[model samples]
Structure formats: structure tokens, C-alpha cells
Target chain A: MVNSFDVARLAGVSQSTVSRALRGDSKVSERTRTLVADAAKTLGYVPNLAGRALSSGRTNRIGLLVTDLSNEFYHRLIGPVVDRVDEHQHEVVLLADNQSTSDIPNRIISLGLDGVILATTTTDSVIPYKLREKNIPFVYFNRIAPAVPADAAVIDLTDGMQDLVNAIKRNGYKRVGAILGPKNATTGTLRANIFFELLAQNEIFVPFDYRVNGDFSIPAGLEGFQELMSREVPPDVIFCANDVVAMGAINAAHVYDIKVPEDVALVGFDDLPEAKWPIFSLSTVGFDLEKLAAVAVDLLFERIENPEADFKTVELPSYYVTRKSLP
Target chain B: MVNSFDVARLAGVSQSTVSRALRGDSKVSERTRTLVADAAKTLGYVPNLAGRALSSGRTNRIGLLVTDLSNEFYHRLIGPVVDRVDEHQHEVVLLADNQSTSDIPNRIISLGLDGVILATTTTDSVIPYKLREKNIPFVYFNRIAPAVPADAAVIDLTDGMQDLVNAIKRNGYKRVGAILGPKNATTGTLRANIFFELLAQNEIFVPFDYRVNGDFSIPAGLEGFQELMSREVPPDVIFCANDVVAMGAINAAHVYDIKVPEDVALVGFDDLPEAKWPIFSLSTVGFDLEKLAAVAVDLLFERIENPEADFKTVELPSYYVTRKSLP
Candidate 1:
């Protein structure tokens, strides 16, 4: 097995120059880098990864921090993120957020991750602060902490919300019901606020009794729909916080023998794959989910490579997809 | 920061002994191990993971290699496997098996995984041989490579098949249509064999045109059901390879305006979470999926610790669940 020393000798460069060239460091002139690369290929030189990592202090492993693995929404993001991370020649280590926020810094240290993607950061989570204090590179994925200024990729729900509200008013839906996500979550809170404000503009109000809060789960959607349906006269339409909740509501409707679009129109956010099934036909807020996931990976890698670069937020746009459930 | 040397000095042992004891090496006596553990705990010494990895050639990172990330069945296993791996003080690295078999050995070598779980190995996959050649620890998860013998955790479909066949016979179903898994996969071949054998015992035959092979996916189920439905005299019942396929068939039924259990009854294997939805009420073969995933992780770690141990296969039992879809 030929080593980088052999390649360096053949290329007429120092071993340190060989290392920098192989790492694609810009400090190494492009011409020298090409010569080193050619020599390495000719010699069949496979760089010792462990030796390189120890020398450079880089793990080449990224951590994806997630709170809920059972959520289809979160798991769906893993595929695209993994694909993107693979392109960067890095492996992904799934880090479950089951431990306390204070334990996160220690966990990251123990795992030896080069960087992390906070996929499920709550607004109040102290993890961002801890990570910043430790100087561990990280980027918020689909969620943001107002107090801890950091890189993020989020969904812009403006156009989607406008389309949804217009459709609801046109459908002659007066009374409304809602199954909102937990108030602590930025995603849930922002979506609920936008939904209610749009409804208010159209002179539609959902009473307190007709609104319920869930933890963005199927069971939550089912129970929330059941609780609202027990009213003297249930609201005509229910806007779910997400597609998972909307699916639950639809399942509940089946159990109650309530006809969708005839008895109650159901709408959801995050047009997940399940939402497009002919059996569901769930009208939903749609965006390029794969692209969002890919962009999050990209932003995290960008931050990792250029730590001094100013933090920025990348907001992906969303639109409404009309389906049988809404019509 | 307390290093291993501090713990070794306090425990009255060599630093090498301290490291081996912390790794739970059989060479270290139980008393010595306990002393080292206690000393390390008292000093609050978090072992330097990267340093240990380099010295011991053990990264404590397990790889889960999957072929398709879009499949819900594969994603669902991540939670339980992650939980089990956490108990063993190892982190999981998600590796996609999208590249050719020739590229797998290099991919594994580059990732620097301590061990791997082959979650989606096809019968023809050469991954097991490559892993063996590399001397990397691995265990088959819910799949088997007959060409390469190894440890595996699989579901026993016997009891479930008996119950399903009995139900079909009792319901007076003569004509049957089926969606079987891929011919190259052990899971698909085994399931199809058992199903057809039992049906033959009762003198019920599924004609070739009424039978189709799928990759155990929703789209496969939809297309298979559609092909059978176009028959001049369609089969009264359709059995899907798995719940995902069953869901697709159910969705296609909705699209074609065909009533489930009235126009046609549908049954599936692998009672996934979506099968229990009131809207689907899919009757499926049920088993302890979490336990199977947990056992796979256990087997992998067991092999890692005792590489010389004889390879064994663990089979979890399954039963048929009766739901509205079957009736």
C-alpha cells in the first residue's frame, strides 16, 4: 500500500503539501494540487482516514439532532439530508434529543461530531446556547431560536396561507375548527397564528371549545377531532397543524361516519407523501420538502467550512395544493 | 478535564488496563474493572472518544445500511435500533446502499464504522462476503443471504399463514388474487411459498395473471391490484405482500370506486402503524417489530463482543390480525 509520502515524493512536494492538496485546501496552488492528485492516483494511495482526522482535527461525521423519531414528518427529512451529506463525503450520525438540553453539549463532544443539524429545536431549548459556548458548528433546520442567532432553513407560509384562506372562504365555510400543534414549538405556534389571523380576516372564528392543541401526532389529531365533534354542532371545517394531524382527523371521520367535504372539510400543512394518496386526497400546503432537507444539509456544511461567515436564514417558499378533501 | 491517566493512577492500574477495563475487555478481571470504573466516575472523566477510537481501532459507531430510504418500513426500524444501540453506548450511522456491490466495501471502509446491520440485503447482494473479507462485524436484519451464512433476526410467518388460510376457507373464498414480494428476496420468496402452499392445501389456486410480484411497496400494490381488477372475472380477495402495498391497493380501490370488503377484500402482511387507521382498518400479519429491531441490534453487538461465537438466527413469531378489511 503506497502512502501519501510516496505520492509527495513523486510529485516533488513536501508531505504537508500533499496533505493540504488532498484536502482541497485553497492554500495549496491548484497546479500543485493537480500534480499531487495525479501522483496519488498512479500510486493507488488511499489516505489513512484516522491519521488524517487526527492531524486535521476533523471527524467528517455530522450529527442530526431529532426529538421525535416516530414522527413521519421528521423521518421523511432524513432521506434527503443523508443524500446531501453523502455528496459532501461525510457520514450522518442520528442523535436523538431524549436527554435534557444541558446534556446536549456533552453528547456532541462524546460523539465526536464535526457539526450538527438541529432538526427539532424548540423555541425555549438551551441547546443552541450550549453549542455556541462550546464552539461546535451547528445550523437550525426548519426551526429557529430567536435568542440564539444562527444559520437556519425555514418554510415561508405566506402565499400558502393566502391561498388556503381564499379557498376556505370560497367554499362557503363559516364555522371553523382547529387542531393546532403544541404552543411551545415555533412551527406549531407560527402556523396556528397565521391560520387564525387569516380566518379572522374572512370573518370566521373558531370558538375555544372547538379548538384543541396536540403534539403533532396522529393520536393527537384523532383525539382532537373527537373532542371537537362532541360539540352541539361541530365546526364545518378543521384546519390541521400538519398533514399527520389531518390524516388522523380523516381516520376519525371514517369512524364517526362523517363524510369529508360534505360534513367537514379537512386541510393540512406539509404535503407529505401520504397526503397525495387517492384514498386521502388531502388538500395541503405544499413545498419542495426534499429541497428543504437538502438545503439544510448544505447550510450546515457551509457553516462548518466557513465558521467566520455571518449567519443567515434561508426560507423556502410554499404553495397550496387543491385536492378532493378540500373541494 | 481528567484524563484516563488520572483514573489509572487513582485505581492503581496501568493506563492500558484502564482503557481495556472501560471497554469491558474479558482480559480484565471484574474487580479491576469495577475499580477503574469507580475511579473514572469519581473523577468525572469523559473518555476521549477520538483518542480511544484511534488507539483501539474501534469508533463505537454502528452503521445501518439500507437500500431504500423512502420506504416507511425501513425508516420505522430506525427508532428501535437507535434505542438499542444507545444502550450499548454506540451511535448509529445511517448508510444508504445505493451504490453497486463493488462500491460497498470502499464505502464501509471510508465511513470507519465499527460494525454494520444489513437491513435491506437482497439474496444476491455480495455485501456479506465483502464485509467478511474486511473482517468487519455485521448481522442480517429482516433479510438473509443464503450464499453467505451469518446471524439474522427474521419473522416466522407460519402461525399467521395458518390463521389467514383458515379465515379465507371459512369465508368461502374460492378465487384468490395475490401480490408477492420480489423473487430475489428471501422474505418475498418465503412469504409467497407459504401462502401458495396453504392455498393449494385447500384446493384454492391463484392464476398466474391474477398473481403479480412487487417490491413490497405502495406503488407495487396499486399496480398489481389494478392489473388483477382488469380481469373479466376478478378475484374476490387480494392479499398484498405487506401493509404498504395493501395501502396502495386500498387507495387504488378508492380511485376506482370499488368498495373494500364489499366488491373486494384486501389482506396484507406486516401490520404497520398505518394499517390500524379506522379509514383503512387493514387486516395484516402482526409481529413484534420493535423487538425484532432490538434483537438485530443485540445480535450485532453480540458478534462485535464475541466474534468467535457461532452464527445463530433468531426468529420472532407472528399472528394474523382480524380487521374490517378482511371481513
Candidate 2:
């Protein structure tokens, strides 16, 4: 609870002098600045964020909004974003959305967030529209909302999917089973479409019974893999939406003593750090996710500082990471 | 920007009437409440947290201060703590002290945090001292500061360690090596001390060269295990501070083509959900981590509501989960 008054009292100066000294105002003498700082430190004084923010009308705090906080792929995105934001002396607040759709938009603004990076935007999401209508500066991470133009950092999956098709053709795999993410998600739908077209080009098509719908969760992957495994005829290879899902599916297959890339092959997306583990050498689509996250944070800052700036879309290219899980 | 005035205009009532109706005050007629609710929905009127907090002198927000958010263990802990906090309609602000400490008590208070849960408090943290001096309500989640007395939810590692030791002895493990966490951390120091005492009671003497220091990180575990393996005569069994660390060590071993259990048996602590994965089958300690996290959140809220309540230390018991890695 120590304040400027206490610092001033110890420094033999007025409270105004203490404030100026702390704020690095030119009016405060060099000798007085040292005296005030030492006193403040001794008294364990911390600057009140609200007081400073209210007076200056500036909160150097940005919110990083993500749907899933515990996901390994998502968690890896936080470090680079936070580090980059901190370099500019701004704070990053992690706002995990567990709210209903109706509550999200208002809640974001009600918190008086200076800006936000939408790390999990969907094509049909109203968040972009609401933020735009409210004139709130935001940038999308790993997702591009085509409907509402905004600065975005996205991963281009076309090249990787083409390579995956090539691999499937080389292996002579005709029956492929897939665990796709929610159909509503831009990523899931886009990947599925691209993958289908590539498969067509390779003269292969999976039956409707071979595909299972799920959200991006381990349990969903396990359930989806189980459904596919118990089919009239199991698939030659199983493709998962991401490495985490693939890990779960592989584990589930292990429960049945199914050898990876022998009994069945597996391919995933988002080459997470865990994918390289010795126990599970999962092949996946790769991109610089951390750098992509940093780009999103940078984009948000740019939009906040220069709202009139041209909206830019950064499409990071992805490639296949060949490993033991996929032939 | 639909304020009370707009709601009042739409409801055909005074601004005060609209406010009363919104709060469901009995002074307002039931007919007026319906009108006000309908107007609020139409105008998208959400209550201002600042105005409410100003009048009530409280903000329904708490801080969860963690040293490492990217760690899988803490990531898992977040889900349960957040679920509990969400049920109480409280917002969580993340505070991280990644490598060094900050003035936590003053910072939390300035941010208007009602309480805080510390997930990674070192033994001699200044945070506990400052919080005690400020009379701020706080709770420890799997961690406690020695200087401050407070409600804490922690795991008792005695049972699990004992079970693991019995398994090792029964299997004729003559020599043991341990990768302990930082010397300053209470959990690390406590586990190491208890483990050594039990080993000695079992008439097993651990060689000085078998011990390695770490910071509870994968890299630390990897390097520490390498350091141990470099010894002329390595131990027969290796015990890591936690599952993540054990995984790192196991991976390091895998790189050298060292077969686990046959080459060197491994054990771990805090058997994470992934330990039971067929790929890992990591023998380690087991406790209800979700329940432990929920208990910590509950303790924080209890401290906030009843500041004068008796300080209690709740220790959750752990047991051994025998898996392939240890056998």
C-alpha cells in the first residue's frame, strides 16, 4: 500500500516530485529521481496499473484469445507471442474463451482490452464482425476469416496435402480412413476439401463409412480411430487432423497391438514438438507455428497503432515431415 | 454503447427503474422487469464491471500466478481451476514469473484481484511475505511458501515413493540414481529428502555421483540424465522428479539405443494422463491432480470469503501405478 506520498516523505520531497521522478518526467532532478526510486524500492511500492492507465488512457495490455489453452499445439504459440509483446513493454493476457457465443464479443470489450489476437477464429465466427463493428483492433492467428477482412497469419496446407497424396499413391493405398476436425471450423473444412481434391488427382477415393467427424481433442481422435478400426474392413492408412489427435489414435491402435505404418499408417498436421518423441515418431504437416503466432501479435499491434494501414494476409507454407508413422 | 438511459427509454421507465429492474430488485414491478430485460436484450446492454466494483468495492476476478504455463502439468491444472472459477462467475488473470520474481502482492491488489493461487511458489518467496503483510487472501496449489501460513492443497508423495521403493527392492535394484528438481523448490527438496531417507531405511546407500540437479524441465532432465549416464558405473534404476522429466530422460536413453528397464529402470512422479499411454507406460506416482487443482481453487475462494478461518494444509495422498518402465 506504499504510495508516492510515502516515497516523497522518505526522499525529503513532495508527492508530485515522487510521481514525476517515477514517470521519468524531465522536471524531476537527477538527484531527486535516485532518492525517490530508492525510497520507493525500500517501501516496496508498485505502480497502480488502473491509476496510470486511467490518467494516461493507455493500457499497454493485449489479450490473446484462444479456444483451447491446454492443447500442445496452441500452448507452443504463447511463448513467442508473449516474448514479442514484452519486447515492446506491453503485457499479454491469455483470455481463454469458455463463454457462450453471445457472451464472447461483449466480454472481450468489457474487459477494456486495448487489443486482441484471435488465435482460433472460424470462417463463420461472429467475433470478427463484432470486433470490426466495435472498431476494436484485432488480428487473426492461424486462421483467415475471408468474410471480414483483417490482418491474418495462416498456414497454407495445399502443398503438404499434395505431398500427402503423392505418398499415398506411392504406397498404393486405396482405402484411407480420416479423422477430420469439426466441419464448421475453417481449417477442418479447408483441409478436408484440399485433401479430397488431391486424392482425386491421385485416382483414389475413401468411402463415406471410412470418415469420422470429431472436434480437435485426444478423446475425439481415439473414438474416431476406434470407429474406423472396427469397420467391415480397416483402412490402409489413417489420417488425423493434427499430431495430438494422431498421438491419441496411435495409442488407441496400440491397445489392439496394431503396428504403426505396418498394420496401418498414420499422418497428422501441425508438427508439434511432441511428434519427434522417440516413442511416437508421427509424420505430420509442418509450419513455423511459433513465428506465425509472433506475426499475429505484431499484426495486432500494427492495427492498433495504425488502423488505416492495409490489411495483410500472411500465408505460411507447410511441408510434409516424413517419419515412421507414415510411409 | 447502450447505456441505462437507452434501456430506460426503450422500457418506458426512469433510468433508476431500469437499473432496479436489471438487478431484479423487488422494488421494481414484475411487468417493468420484463420490459427492462427485453430492452436490454434488444440494445445489447451489459453491466459495467467497473461501476459495479466501485459501488460494491470488489471485483470478482482472481489471479493465477504460475512460473511456467507451457509445462504440461500446469496446463492440465488450468482446466480444473478454470472450471471451478468459471462456476463462481469469476474471471482469471494469468500472472507469470517466468525466470525471476516481481512484487506480486501489490501488483495483484492494484489489478483489483480478489485472491490469487500460486502454482509454483519457491520455498523463500517474497510474495508470501508481502501477501501476509497486505492481508491478501491467497491459496497454494501444489506449492507453499514456508514463511507464510495459508490454506494449501498439496500432494503427499510418501505413499507413492514407498510403493515405488518396494517395487524396486523386490525387483533387486541394487543401485539407484535420481534426477532431483531445483534445490530451492520445496517439492523438489522434500521429495529428495524423503526418498533418500526411505532408501537408507531399506539399507540402500545411494552413491553421490548418482544425484543430478535440474529445474523441472525437459532439457534439464535430458542433460541431467546424460550427466548420470556418463558416469563410469551408472545406477541400475533412475528416478525422475516428475513424469515430464522422466520422459526426457527416457528419450535421451532412446537416442543411445538403451533399452528401458533392462538397461536401466525408470520411475517418475505425478503420473500425468499421458503416462498410461501405451507408448509411455511410465511407472510413476498417481494422485487426483484434477481434484487437487479444484481443492486449491476452493481454498482460495474460502480464504476470500472467510479471511478469519483457520489455516489448514490439505495433503492429497498418492500411490504407485506400476507400469512397464519400472518393471
Candidate 3:
């Protein structure tokens, strides 16, 4: 039951000084901070974050809002985001936007998070607007709500898609099929649009029946691939929205006894770690995952520090990685 | 700017009643709760958890302490844990026990978490002791610190190990090798001990040089497999610490142009989702992951509600899953 008062008495400092030292206030000298830390440790005086948060209106906790926790794509981002947030002496709480949960914005507000990194915002998501209304700072991680002007770290799929399309043309892929991600997600919509535009420009048009739109998930890819393959004349090549989806497509190929590349070439975006596995050897668009995560966290911290600061969108470049999946 | 008072006024209730209704206190009438909720929604009043936490001595925030967020094994557990915690109307904050940062216990206290699900406790870890001293409620998720008696949801490896060893013996494997997990970790040490004992009972002994102890990670599996393979006499069958490590071993096999089961049979514990991938078809020890996560959360909540309750250890059963990895 030792309190800050006990630590202050032991450290021969005032209660306010003890608080300042423990909070790592720059005004407190390093020597004083060390002394206060030692005294606090000796007394087992854990600082009351609730009381401090009440006073300073800062919780030092950020909410990482993700749509699907089961997806491997978000799994890759969590570690990097947590590490970067830790550098700022902040904690990351997972805020799942479960489709069944309708009160996420209220929950986020109730938690009193210092900021949030929105990794699952769809193009028309209402969460961003709700956050803005409440003055809760948030940065879009991989997707953005176009209606809301906010800081975001996104991938530039233009060059990567162009390169992939060119490669497909060079390989003489007669019929192209695609397993697209959710149309509502900018990550899915933007990538699909740019890819189709590039393909059309390259004189290789994908038929309407050749494309399937689903969420960025393995099941989506598996079902989409199955649907496309059921066609009387299936496409010679299938472009998956992301690596997770490509893995699903690969799984579907296994289920259907179809050999990849020889039967139907497959390409995926976001060169996830599994894409490099010898079994997959998947051709994908690669980007610096760590940088993307760092950027998202940095943008969130910036928004937290300066709510009035003009929002900015930073786009990281992506490059195509040719692997055994491509013919 | 909207607060509880405004909602209370609008809902025709006292401020305390509004608070009780919003908090879902059982004493509050159902009609009053609905009225308060509607009023709060109309006014856009989000309850301040910090203020409520200070008065109630509860934050409704639980910490999920994990060692490695990058590993896929933990990935499978995260979603289930989050969902189960959500059912209790509690939020899950991820607390990474980074090796370099030694003030984790203090961080946990500072966060004022209601309870913690320790998913990464080593046998000799000081975290459990610190948590115990502070009277912080915690439940061991998968690993336990034997020194500290607390509620734990762990896997019983006896049946699985016995079955796996019987299979190995039936296959007529003369040589056996293992990539063991860290000796300090109960998950590693316990699994290794049980496997070895069962192997010895079946009259199969693993040579000293045939074992390499490392963390339960892919790199550990990969390096261990490589090291064992480089030996003049490699074991015909290699057992990995866990599925992630087994994947690393598989990767190494590919790197060395060694066909699995043909060149060297392999086995792994923890039948992760990726184990079912056609590329892996990893033979592993399987358990009810969702049940384990739910049980861990339930134990922590029980400890939180009744701190004086007798500590209980719930051991879930594990079973062997045979796949293409085994000869």
C-alpha cells in the first residue's frame, strides 16, 4: 500500500517532484529521476496511471484497430507496431472491430486511448468520423476512409501492378483471372482497379466472369479460385489480392489437384513471409513491412501530439518479386 | 463536451443512476439502462474509464503477456483470447515481454490492468513473483512457474507423447534427434522431458549431440536442423520443439535438398493452422486452442473476482495428429 508520498519522503523530494520524476518529465534532472526511481522501487510504489491520466489526459496507450485478428497479414504488422510504440514509451491495446460489435467507437472513447492506428478502416467506415468528432487522434495504417482527411501510411501499388502486368504479358497469359479483396476496402479496390487498367492498356482484358470479389482472406481466395476454375474455360493465370489469398488459392489448387504455373499461374501482393516458403515460392509484390508499420505508428504518435496539425498521407513504394509461382 | 450529468438530466435519472445504468450494474433496472444508453447516444456521451476506474478500483483491462509476437504459434491464440476477454466486457492490451526491457512487471502495475493472462512465463521468471507480491491477479495461459502456485490452464502432453513415441518405434527409427525449446521455459522443458521419458520407456534413446536447445522459433528449428544434419551421423527422425520450429526444420530440409520423411522424418508439437497446409502436412501434437485461450481468460477473471479462491491448475489433453511429415 506504499504511495507516492512514501517514495517522496524516502527520496527527500516533494510529492510533485516524485510524480514528475516517475512521469519522466524533462524538467526533472536525470540524477533526480534516478533517485526518485530507486526510492519508488524500494517502496514498491507503482504509479497510479488512472489518476495520472485523469490529470494529464494522456494514457500512453494506443489502440491498434484491426478487422480480422486471424488473418496473417495483420499478424505481421502487430509485432512491428508494438515495438515502435514501445520506443515511444507507449502500450498497444488490440481493438478488434468485430462485425457483430456495433459500439466500437464508443468503446474506443471509453478506453481513453491516447491515439489509435486504424489498420482496418474501409473506404466508407464511420469509425474515423466518430473518432474525429470526439477529437480522438487516429492514423490510417493500410487503408483510408476517403471522406475523412487523416494522416495515413499506405502502399503505392501502381508500379508493382504495372510490372506484374508487363510480366504476365511477356509470359503470354491468354486468359487472366483474379481473386479480388472486398470492394469496400481501398486496399482491394485500388489494387484491383489499377491492375485491370494496366491489363486493359496492355491489351489483356479480364472477363467479368473471371473476377471474384471477397474479403482479404484465405477462404475468400479458396472459394474464388474454385469458382473461377469451375468455368468451362478457366484462365491460364490467377492474380490474388494478397499473399494470404494466394495461399488460399494454392490450397484450392491442391484440393482440385491442379499444378500451379503449369495449370494456372498465380500472383499475390504483399510478399508475406509465407510467400517465400519453398512449397509456395509465390510471386508477389514486396515492400518494407517494418517501414510500413513504423510509419503507421509514427503517424499516430504525430497525430496524438498535434491534433491540429495538417494531415498527410505517406505512400511507400512496392516492387514485384518474381518467384516459382510465375511461369 | 457531453458528460454523464447531461445524459442523466436527459434520461430523467440521477447522475449516479446514470453511471450505474451505463456500467450495466445488475441493480439498475433494464428500462433505466435502456433510457440512459439512449440518452447517452443522443448526447454522444462516452464514459470516461479512467475516472470510473479510480472510483471503482477496476479498469476492466487485462494484459496478455506474450514473449514473441512474431511467432505464428502465438498468433493462433491471440484472436481467441481477445474474443473471450471481450465477452467479459474487458479490453485486452498486449504486453510484450521484450528481453532487453527489464521493467515489465512495473509496466504492468503502472497500466493498472485488472488481471493478466501470462502466456509466456518461464520456470524461473521473476514476473510471476512480482505479480504475486503486488496482489495482481494472473493466470498462467500455457506455461507455469512451478514456484508460484496460481490458476493455470496448461496442456497435458502424456497421451500425445506416448502416442507419438509409439509411432516412431513402429516406424523402426534407429536414430532420434531433437530441437528442444529453451530450458527455462516450462513449455519447452516439460514437452522435452515427457517426450524423452516416453522415448526411453519405448527403448529409444536420443544421443546428446542429437539435441539442440533454443527458443521455440523457426530460426531455432532451422539452425538446429542444419546443425544436426551437418553431423557425420544425423538422426533418421528429428523432433522439433513446436510447430514454428518444425517449419524451420522443413525450410532447412528444402534448403539442403533433403526430402522430408524420405531423407529425414520430422515431428512437431502444437498443431498450428499452418500445419494443415498441403506444403507442410506437419505431423504434430494437437490440442483445443480456443478452449485453452477461453480457459485462461476464465481463470484470470475468477482470480480477479475472488482473490482468495484456491488456486487451480486445469490441464487440457493433447493428442497426436499424424500427417505426411511422419514416415
Per-structure clash totals for the candidates: 0, 0, 0
Per-residue CA lDDT of model 3 for A216-322, tens digit only, reads 88888889999999999999999998999999999889778999999999999999888887768899987889899999899888887777899989999999999
Best candidate, lDDT-wise? 3
lDDT, candidate 2, A192-218, per-residue tens: 888888897777887889999887777
TM-score of each: 0.92, 0.84, 0.93
Scoring only chain A, what TM-score does candidate 3 earn?
0.92
lDDT per residue as tens, model 1, A84-128: 888777788887777333255567776668899998836887788
TM-score of chain B of each: 0.91, 0.86, 0.94
What candidate 2 gets wrong by more than 4 Å, as runs, is A1-45, A56-60, A88-93, A98-102, A121-124, A162-176, A204-207, A229-234, A308-310, B4-43, B53-59, B99-112, B133-136, B170-172, B225-234, B306-310
In angstroms, how far off is B298's CA in candidate 2?
2.6
Give the alpha carbon lDDT tens digit for every residue of B1-327 in model 3. 888899999999999999888777899999999999999989978899878887789988999989888888888889999999888888888877873553789889888899999998467778889989889999998877878889999999888988899889889998999999888888888888989998898778989999999888878988999999988988899999999999989988978898899989999988998888776789998899999999999999889989999999999999999999994
Query: A48, model 3: CA deviation in Å?
Result: 2.3
Instruction: Please give the distance, in angstroms, between residue B18's alpha carbon in candidate 1 and its true position after superposition.
Output: 5.8
Taking the tens digit of each residue's C-alpha lDDT, what string does model 2 give over B1-327?
Answer: 689899999889999888667644678888989999899889998766545445545565777887776676676676667667766656676666672333445566666577888887477677877777767788988877766889999988889889988998999999899998988888888888888988999999788889998988777768888888888988889989888888888878877887788888888888887787776789998799878988888888888879999998899999999999997
DockQ of each: 0.50, 0.38, 0.60
Q: Which stretches of candidate 1 lie over 4 Å from their true place?
A: A1-48, A99-103, B1-45, B99-102
- After superposition, the stretches of candidate 3 with alpha carbons farther than 4 Å from their true spots are A5-14, A25-45, A99-102, B6-14, B27-45, B99-102, B231-233
Name the weakest run of 10 consecutive residues (lDDT summed) in model 2 chain B: B99-108
Interface RMSD of each: 3.1, 3.3, 2.0
